[model samples]
Target: MRVFGMGSKAWLLNCAILFACPIAAQAAQDNGHGKNASHAAAGAHVHQISNHTTLASGAKVSHALHTASGKRVATRSFGISCVPYARQVSGIQVAGNAWQWWDNASGQYARGDRPETGSVLNFRANGHMHLGHVAVVTKVINSREVIVDHANWQSGGGVSHGVAVVDVSEANNWSAVRVELGREGTFGSVYPTYGFIYNRPDTGVVLASVSRPAPQPSINPVPSDLRPLAERPWRTMEEVAESPSTPRHTIDLGINAGVSR
Candidate 1:
């Protein structure tokens, strides 16, 4: 009803506009929520991409087309040990096994649990990794994510670069890490780390040196046992010799008799 005697049609029209405005606004708000949900999904996809580091050409070939079948991806590089590779690339200058690099850098370089670019990430030895491992950090994406260059992680002393290392430790410390392998954006192994060895922290990404000699494993070649020693027992030299029966044939003891032609 109109209070000021306004026309019925006009009053109805005014009421319709008032109610329609809120309804339209609510519909727009609902559409906005839908748009926000789509944006959130896209953001999640981008974050997943960020988890993967750049893949090397060889690694790409090795890991490309891999599936969740739990199959192995073989690296092309013949053999590259982590120690020398870390030394040359990161310039840490430490020698010996990768596990030892942490302690080896004790007085020589600064060491810490945080990730740093160009620092040597020292992995602790475990049941699977007897000698441990070392890798040169090329980029620190965040506290828990980084890209690394190392040798012999997969291949026999084969070098791999631009691999992702994610800190999985409960304390947010880099005590444990999962390595992105085969350049396929797949993480194969989770390793325990001692820490990062900081020397030339500012050094940027360095390519793998495929020309460097791979770690040569010592080989002792022994001649094959040609004889079946079990079948033919050999006598020791200590057995005493028996002299000729003194001469039941002594007639034959004469030198001339022994020399009978």
Candidate 2:
């Protein structure tokens, strides 16, 4: 993985496009492309967890870019898109065990990187966890709290949205975060159909997220329910990756912990 400093020219461009376009519209145009599939595949093959570096209460996390051929890809810190998952680009399988962390092909999330406001949010599945496409981070409340809107986080296929405020006082454990259920749905109906968030690298460790139960799927689908509030035209990856406000950074994290070969 190639590490870099946060806040680069690319980051600025990313921010501009990310905020300018509507989330729903973007997803609609680029729903479930080869990129997401590649990341999902890479996530399926990674092994081991808990080896990445950490921060001291909101320390900036670093990021890197790796090519599909096990080559280091050039990236500007948080500016790189976690949207579609890393494996999607590398054609690698994301490694994970029953109820474990979804390790990207290059172990993307755990790497110390700067977090963005709307990047893809990740969670650990304690054990025997087998659900896919779970939730989205609707809002970020300071460095300690976040709001999650999910559809099928639970088994019943219920959809619900709630807020989770991270607990900084207690080892940054999400046990203190607040979770509230609002509605119900089946699978990714009310949740993410295919979206990414601008996430800060330290979000998972520093701000413990509160995990809540997803709502039960309704017998009948809600009409006009899943339509995203905003819609926009689709753009090429180059276009998408070249907007302002992308948050650039110099690659600097030390890659001591290697992914299982």
Candidate 3:
């Protein structure tokens, strides 16, 4: 796998990219900003969601990035959505919106009202979640409860890891569930689900497609006075803003988390 690069860089990002690209494409499709409209039109569903990450005050700095050219550019990249994250991570090999995952997995993957580790919990399309949502089950706490890791769930494209999900279905089925909104003890509204799509990671197309370049990032000039500092002739406003104690690295990125690692 050429995409398998070396070093601490591969620590978290190497594996994350294999699944992140498709996820970003799904986002590009929904936002109608990219070339996936016709392809996305193949289905009406697949819904959307986000996570929590309060960007720096006064500017959305969370997704901002500085290119290698030292141009001090700004790229507004929202983090990964749930669909591609669930698909590639769970190896479900299904495409479309998050809501359509259940039907998409009809003959391809095993699904049911029960939760299982590594399974994709497919949420139904409802008034609240128009495109629907999908999450990768991380741990099954019990027959009626589980922990899931998913992106774009709370706010800022932040991935919520080991979040508790309680089954709220009347029949004790996992047809409906409420996710932990933030800190423990605070849960959100009841969400209908089509159940869990269970399967092992398919190393076929989904994994192979890690070779695809990350989604194109939206570029903007980093606001600066264009005055180079005496000590550091290349210093930009953002570079100056970063903590002086923080190590510096020039990272040119397109949508996959902005930071290299």
Candidate 4:
């Protein structure tokens, strides 16, 4: 099995193609229908399309697709979770369970209680976070506070950007941290964490055990004008088509005329 790297543009392209193909196929079959029939079919198609969110590299991503009944369905995107996100940003490449990252890094990546840029902060599973969580350290504000970019923490449940993580541990260590949820400077739930995964000359870096295949480029490139689905709440197929960035094919997904992506 080939494991592809996360957060790359190639991955996004793959997602776009994955969503676009079925719509194209369905549109071909629906052609020649009358005006009212087309409208009904389109409405039915929108409902059939699945609207589910998935965790990729720890970031929440939506992979919406259409079904025959026009009822929306939700499916997980390519098994992407928090560990992959940490590996992608930190270049540590340690695999296995998210909670196991700390132990897995022994003799490979340096482990520490302090925060540093490019390090992976491993959160220990607690009552709230059952499987545990991992995030990348983007900036160190002071001894007590740091800024991080992580996936699956936002209320809408995608990627949370530039959030603050404050060390609330008693020993002044990073044993416990309160992460910023949505609002800037407002820390959310306090999660217990193992510590930070660092890459230093003394600690050494562990190469990934599994080799990931190069991502297959999408047959159609996402139009430059298209806005990322992650940026906003879920939108209907019609809304997506009406957006300025939506490709002609997306608009054609049972809507206007010919298909475009």
Give the best candidate by lDDT.
1
Candidate 1 per-residue C-alpha lDDT over 105-166 given as tens digits, one digit per residue, 9 for 90 to 100: 76678777777788888888876778888888977765656777778886556676556666
Model 2: per-residue Cα lDDT over 1-261, one tens digit each: 234444565788899888878976778668767676665554333221111113343343221222464432121111222322333332223355211223442224332212234433444332223233423454554343444544444444433333232322232322212222222111112221222323323245432234432222112222222222342122323345566776765554468444333
Where does candidate 1 have its weakest 10-residue lDDT segment? 217-226
- Per-residue lDDT tens digits of candidate 4, residues 175-261? 666654332223354566788888664345432213232222111112121223342233534465778974453455575657565
Order the candidate numbers by TM-score, best to worst: 1, 3, 4, 2
Query: lDDT, candidate 4, residue 251?
Result: 52
- Report lDDT (CA) for all predictions: 0.60, 0.33, 0.58, 0.56
How much RMSD separates candidate 2 from the native structure? 29.1
Off by over 4 Å in 4: 1-80, 154-157, 201-261
Candidate 3 per-residue lDDT over residues 66-89, each given as its tens digit = 235422221112368888777667
The parts of candidate 3 lying over 4 Å away from their true place are 1-78, 200-261
Weakest lDDT window of 10 consecutive positions for candidate 3: 57-66
Ranking by lDDT: 1, 3, 4, 2
What TM-score, to 2 decimals, does candidate 1 have?
0.48
lDDT of 3 at 140: 69
